[model samples]
Target: MPQKKLMLLGGLRYLLPVIEEAHKLGVYVITADYLPDNIAHKYSDEYCNVSIIDKDAVLRAARELKIDGILSHAVDPGVTAAAYVAEKMGLPFQCSYEAACILQDKSLFRKFLSEHGFNCPKAKGYTNVEDALEDVGFFNWPVIVKPVDSAGSKGVTKVTDKADLKSAIETALSASITKNCIIEDFLDKVGAQSSADIFTVDGKLVYPAYSDQLFDKNAANPYTPAIEIWPASMEQKFQDDLTAQLQRLFTLLGVKSGIYNVESRVCSDGKAYIMEVSPRGGGNRIAELQDMATGQSLIVGEIKKALGMPMDDITAPQYDGVWCNFILHSSEEGSLVSIEIDPEFKSKYVRDVGLIVKPGDHITPFKGANNSLGTLFLRFETREELDAAISNPDSWVHIKLK
Candidate 1:
């Protein structure tokens, strides 16, 4: 049999490990995107210059390359395109083409959840600002306005007053490639929101792990997650309930054999609502952190399934210790000089501390996952210690810039 050929979308750093794993399995890898300068292209077996946002363009490139499988990880631009190509060419896929559309578009996803009896907030999509402004009164105060198709909090704004609604809509529409925006009620969170990674084999959920989302309220964009702790502080019963809800969702959508990074929240009403069900691996290295905490290979499983290989039973580990992954970023825009981590943080439990920007490199303030300078992965002996350190991170962690 000939080697399996995989065409990956976007050249982000997260694809680095996926490409390496494919190579180890003797699979041919082709990384495609308009930017050939992306780091992942340097490591891929081959690189194709095509814009991932243009579905037809990507499909054409995949056909010319004779790709056996098409998939994307940790990138939002290729989710729809991946499903489109796989469905058109008769390849194994995570979900149907129609379901992919619903998941990729925030407005469509909200409507789908509501129609399916999921506890989703009432939301609406718009193409123009005037229509959105006219219907602003439909929702109560404090709503979230965001691009219908973008991710990583790129164009998300929390609108409390009517005066800010129009500007928020314009911002969201500008971020959107389709010039679409969605508005929905912003739930009063019970505590921290949770983002987790779950995998399904043939539509059966096999492994599940949840993490408590940490936020930097002072960051440029306050909504973006700053730090995340594995084995979320949520009650076991609640976690189990969320897992069941996810199982129902994938089963309803006929999702099979792929990874999902799900965002959910227990609102002030004490009801769990599924916030977002991202069909691809999340951008913040959530899958990698999930693997480390749960002792399962989320990334490897995704790779195997994408190549149409057998999937072993991966169990969700009952984490005995806490793991933390900090989505490191700056709060100011300037050329980075260096990062200074205090000796207190250089513990033996520190797994890795990666900084993407070197001296003299321009670093943007935290707005989205794309603006992440790097990640800091560490393990703690106890949740108490983890809580203490994160509660007062300013005293130890410092970023130096000129």
Candidate 2:
């Protein structure tokens, strides 16, 4: 028999490790996207110039290639496209096409959660700014506005005043391909946000991993995750409650075998709320961090699930130490000169470093995951040390530029 073939959508750098994993297992890898110069295409066995956002077109390409399995690991658009192709081609899929639509669209997902009694923010979607502003007085102050379908916090905003509502809605509308945006009551978090990777197999939740989602308030886009700590700092009781809610959601939404990027928080009212759960690998090495902390390869598990292989590696994750990931970024735009990690923490704490840009490369201001300069992996001996470093990263790490 011929070797199994894997078709990956969107040629982002995150697909590189997936391509490598397929090659290691002797599977042919085909990367597809509209851009010809995407880095992942260089390592793939073949390249297809199909737009991942166009579900029907991508499905046609997959059929022509006779792909054994379809996957879109770390990219947002790939999630729905991969599901669409997989369902149409009779390939293994983690979630149904209907479920993907709900998870991909913020309006549908929020509505589903509220209807099902899941702890979710009161949200409503609108196609035009005028409609969104019409009911501004109905909501509490300090609301969040975001695109209905975009990811990476590309158009997320926190509006504390009614005067800023229209601009926020317009910003979100611009980012959404559907020209739709959601305005929701802002949740007051009790602690750092709980955002991490979770897994499921055959419609049953295998395990739920939690992380301490960190943010740089001074960041141009403060909604994006700036740092994440494994085995979150949340109380055990809250974590357990969150897990129960997640299981309910997985079963309700028909989430099948695969890794899921989930977000939640313990609110000030002492309730755990399921903020978002997307059926795709999160950008910025979340799966890699899960592998580092938990001894399980989410990437491999995703590949196996997509290819109809046994997911023997899907086990309860146990973190060996307090692990963390820092998404290195700059708030200013310029050519990179040199990246300097303060020697104070480098000798025994930092485990690995991935610098995506070299000296003299023009770098944009950090607004989303796409602007991340690189990632730093740390294995802390204690939780205190990890917390300290994360709370004040500027003192220990700095990216210099011209």
Candidate 3:
């Protein structure tokens, strides 16, 4: 029998595990992107040098390769393209191409939520700064401006004053691939925001895992998640409500079995809002962390589903203990000297440290997930210990820069 071919759309390090799983399943892995030097390509059986964001180009490559399935994985820019190719080839995908478009664009997602009577913030998308400035009064104070099509919080800004609106719009537009941006009322969350990966089967949510998405205010981009702890502190009632709403949203969109990166929050107004939902694994190794906390592997299940194979049994995860995935980054831009972790913390809490950079390598301040040096996996016996350690990471985790 011929080996099944799986075409992955991005070359990010996140695809490394997917490639490994595919190889374990006796499948051929092909990493596709314009960059030939991407790390995932090194591990893949073949490399396709085509722009993943260009759907037509990717479709051509997929046809030539005779691929059986395709996935975008943690790469946001290629989700729509992957869907397009999957639909054209009658392959498995989480949702249709149209649904992928709606989920991938922040502006369209907000509109969909509002139309569906979800707890959606008042927001507007703009292609030009002049028009957004003209409609400044449309939104409430303390609004967030972000690109309509970018992820990892690449161009997200919190603007409390009208004076900063135009510049924020420009920043968002620059980050956007479609030259579009959205201005929306910021939901002052009741507690820590939730950003984690969840799974669904036949449009019904099967696994719901939530995390307390943390950010470092001292970082260049406070919007990017700096640390994500499993078992979010959100009340159980709210979590249940959010899970039901997510299932409904998926059913309405005709979503099937796959993993989704979800961002939600309970606002001070006593309403739960689904901030964002994308049909792809989240960056920052969210699925990987879930595997550590629970004995289940979403990565393996996702690989199986992508290849038109029956998925492993997926159910609600029972976390063994509190866990956090700390994104390693620097507060200042310079050549790296070394990463220092307090001896006591390392011995007691830290489970693993993965560093991408070494001494003499140049590094930059944390602006987005792309700016991260690597990750640190830590397990805590209690939530209190986890909170205390993350709150004062400077005392234990230090990045010496020259």
Assess candidate 2 and give its lDDT. Answer: 0.87
Worst 10 residues of 2 by lDDT: 308-317
Error of 3 at 214 (Å): 0.9
TM-score of each: 0.97, 0.97, 0.98
On lDDT, the stronger of 1 and 2 is 2
- Which candidate model has the greater TM-score, 1 or 3? 3
172, model 2: CA deviation in Å?
A: 0.6
Predicted structure 3: lDDT: 0.92
Better of 2 and 3 by TM-score: 3
Tens digit of lDDT per residue, candidate 2, span 94-149?
A: 79999998998999999999999988888999999888888988777789999998
Deviating ranges (above 4 Å) for candidate 2: none
**Model 1 residue 146 CA deviation in Å:** 0.6
Q: Could you tell me which 10 consecutive residues in candidate 1 have the lowest summed lDDT?
A: 311-320
After superposing all C-alphas onto the true structure, candidate 3 shows an RMSD in angstroms of 1.0
As a whole number from 0 to 100, the lDDT of residue 69 in candidate 1 is: 89
The per-model lDDT (C-alpha) reads: 0.86, 0.87, 0.92
Which residue pairs collide in model 2, if any? none
- Residue pairs in clash, model 3: none
TM-score of 3: 0.98
Model 3, which residues run further than 4 Å from truth? none
